[model samples]
Target: MSSEAKPLSGLRVLIPRGGPWGDLVSRALRERGAHTVTAPLVDFAHTSEEDQLVDALKRLEAGEFDWMTATSSTVADVLTHHNAVIPQETNVAVVGEATAVAFRDAGYHITRTPERENSTHALLEEWSEIDTGDVLKVLTLRSDVAIPVLTEGLIDRGHDVTQVLAFRTVGVPASVHIREDIESGRINALLVASAKIAEEVAAQFPQLPENTIVACVGVNTLEVAAALGLPDDADDPAHADYELKRALIESVESVIDQSDMLD
Candidate 1:
């Protein structure tokens, strides 16, 4: 389609995370004729309990666990950074497609992922259907600040579960120019992917233009954004980059329709 025919033509979108994922999202936005500003609002740091993490990975490589759970892409990065190995007999489960892709990119195979939603609750529900045998040993790797929903749910099912903090999520403030653009309404939409990013956005950019859209990646993030005082402009249940793109496009179109009606 021509640039003028694209739904997002002349739009400026703010992507709150940088690196490979941000690059991918930026490319998608540009394909739709939107100018993307890539600013990382959150970053990962090595866990404080480095020894504990190392020991857990050692056990993981020794084939002590029957199943391994990866909740985020950062967990996959941790595994790759540590050179952790998963035996052929071990099955790997992920919370969402993004995490599965991360694991696959790290040379790991995924055994299962939630069919409908990309949250821990959804993963747990899916696990109940395929769960079999007695007391399967499970290893769950997650961020330090993440709730232990998946780990607790597995334990309740009578599985031997080991919970390891894979990394720490830290907030990064956006550049002054980026902040100014957001405050001045130069930004057309803000993409929020996680609760932490939402929190940082709320903290850093307290006031947004009345017409600017706050697009969330999933239901969980939308809830967090609502709590943070961000408008419920758009959200995608799939929690994938492509889904976010669709939400942004539809939202912008809706806004344009409303403005046209007013004019």
Candidate 2:
């Protein structure tokens, strides 16, 4: 493995993801000697906004959707935990094995799940075997920050889609403790999980040092950073941040060089 792409040894990384997904990223970074902290930038709850998705759920029960894709377990949690029953014949697709497990535990059999490249485009391609007409509504039970790609693609393919807001994702203003870490340089890089997280963070701190390296999970995330006037590269992704770190192991100097560019 390239040295630079290895675990962020001797570096401090901050993750702004919400829910158990954030915990996964934190654990990966810690395995590489990087001290990790998750100051949840967003929070999730199914009850705060049910009306918007209730119709979608009602539709789901009626077998209105052919394939249901849950972006995160939180979405699955919202579906199965509080009286949400996914419709019959609704072949389930999950973004990752973790989410697939959640769907399985919820008593739903998952038909498709991706091991690598966890993104909407990935999910779209994974299920490409199904003809356009076979898929009706691709219900993506996700947060407000969820992008439009998968749903749009399904539409482009002549399939209807319903992206329900199963939960609200809002930033928690940086706490005094977090600000102290940033200002003190205790945090070396701001690893972003989504474009929304990057956009919101940059908006909150416009004068934030351009020096902060944004190690991200995918292209859309990078776009969000660039849109907010922050530097970004193609490798940034929300779902596979650890894969990037592993890739860096073989190219430490290259990563540090990228870090230098951010600084």
**Candidate that would win on lDDT:** 1
Query: Model 1, 1-263: lDDT tens per residue?
Result: 89887766767899876654565567767777888998889998999888989998899889998899877767888988998888888898876444666788889988887665555676777776337757888888888767677788888888888888888989998998999999998986787777788899899988788667777665556688888888654444543344445746454332121111010
lDDT computed for candidate 2: 0.62
Candidate 2 lDDT for residue 143:
66
* Candidate 2 residue lDDT tens string, 110-201: 87764445555566676765563564667766666666555566778877677666776666777888877876667756776566678667
Residue 7, model 2, lDDT? 55
- TM for every model, in the order presented, reads 0.79, 0.74
CA lDDT, every model vs. true structure: 0.73, 0.62
Clashes of each: 0, 23
